[model samples]
Target chain A: MPIIINLDQVLADRNMKSKELAEIVGITEANLSILKSGKAKAVRFSTLEAICEALDCQPGDILAFSSPNPSQGGESN
Target chain B: MNLNTFFKRLIDLAFYLMVPIVVFFPGTILYVLMFPEQTIINVNIPYVENGFSGKALLFSMGFFALFLLFFAGLYQMRKFAGLLLKNKLFSQEVVKRTHKTGTFFTACALGSLIFIGINSLFSYEGKISVTFGSSNFNLLLFLLIVGVLFLLLSDAFKKALAIKEENDLTV
Candidate 1:
């Protein structure tokens, strides 16, 4: 739950539209949104490679780990 | 008795069987709504008449209504199932209402079947007898009550589910 998807940040830096990237990445808009919202249960390695190649960024630039425990200063219920 | 799941299955099966029956039986809306004076139900037996010929129109209408009910039930199942799968919506209160509604619809369907069956069984053809009786009476009341119960129940569950949705932004 704490796997942060910094998809929006990557798009902002790359000056890309989410829809365009979604199309280029061959993913549905809804699936792309799930990635954007950090609600995706898992991201395919192929999708990760596509995102990295598209934005010309390393995986670290797009994903970071966040603890789900609110006591650890991350999102929680 | 899990009326929702039970009736839901019945509704799904009935819809599959009845959709073509309802559609081909009447090509136009007006045709389905307005009863034909006399209908020959079985073609093989050149002289077999149906029970109260135009009444089959009523039966068809009832079946069509069942189709609508099935659609609505399928939709409700989809919504609740999505919520359940996504871990987004649940409350003991909601579960309780679902139980009550299952009971209500089951009771309504059963009562309708029983009353219609008994009255039709005993009554003579073309008798002005009101066994299911007076327009403002018990049968009419039961129909009205059941109809309103389903309408209100559907609306209430919708609102309750909406309230359970998480906005994430903590508004």
Candidate 2:
């Protein structure tokens, strides 16, 4: 859950539609939607590679890590 | 025929057969109780003053209740088999049915033990005898073991279903 999918941002930057990306990546629209909505449990490396190839961007451009509880920094009780 | 179709027909046949047993078994018992003389089977209690005394009726009712519990377990099994034919093995419904079946079997085993205990208490003879070597006792023990196994299986299915869902969402 902490690993955020910035697919929408990347798609927007590439000036591409979800349908177009899905067609090029050889995945169903529903799966693409799941990835975009951050509902996916995991994204396969092959899928990540395909998405990166399609959008002409790095995997970092699509994935971001954000702390769920940012204020509860490096110390544990 | 292919294995799936064969199994489907077998399950269907079993389901139909079980339906009548589930429905008519209680009805037959009630009829037998109502007209004891009309039936071949004599309803008699050993050492009781009357052939069908209040105590005898109470024991019959206890037996009936236990039978109902056993039938309920069979019904759950039927449901589970139906689901299996549909290829829905890992569904929540299957888990629930299995768990219920397990519960009914366990309850029947416990209920039988209680019935035996009560029967022993009510016997006119001063002797208290609990026969462990009887066929009925063995059957009850088997049912108890089977029930616990099913309960454990349901727990396993629950964990498997969670993992399956997670895998599905993994894309």
lDDT of the candidates, in the order given: 0.58, 0.80
lDDT tens readout by residue for model 1, B63-107: 456445544444444444444444544554445444444444444
Where does candidate 1 chain B have its weakest 10-residue lDDT segment?
B40-49
Instruction: Identify the runs in model 2 with alpha carbons over 4 angstroms from their true place.
Output: A73-77, B1-41, B44-49, B124-134
Worst 10-residue lDDT window for candidate 1 chain A reads: A68-77
Q: Per-residue lDDT for A1-77 in model 2, tens only?
A: 77788898888988999999999999999999999999999889999999999999998888888767878553221
Query: Could you tell me the lDDT of residue A29 within candidate 2?
Result: 96
Task: Write out the backbone clash pairs for model 1.
Answer: none
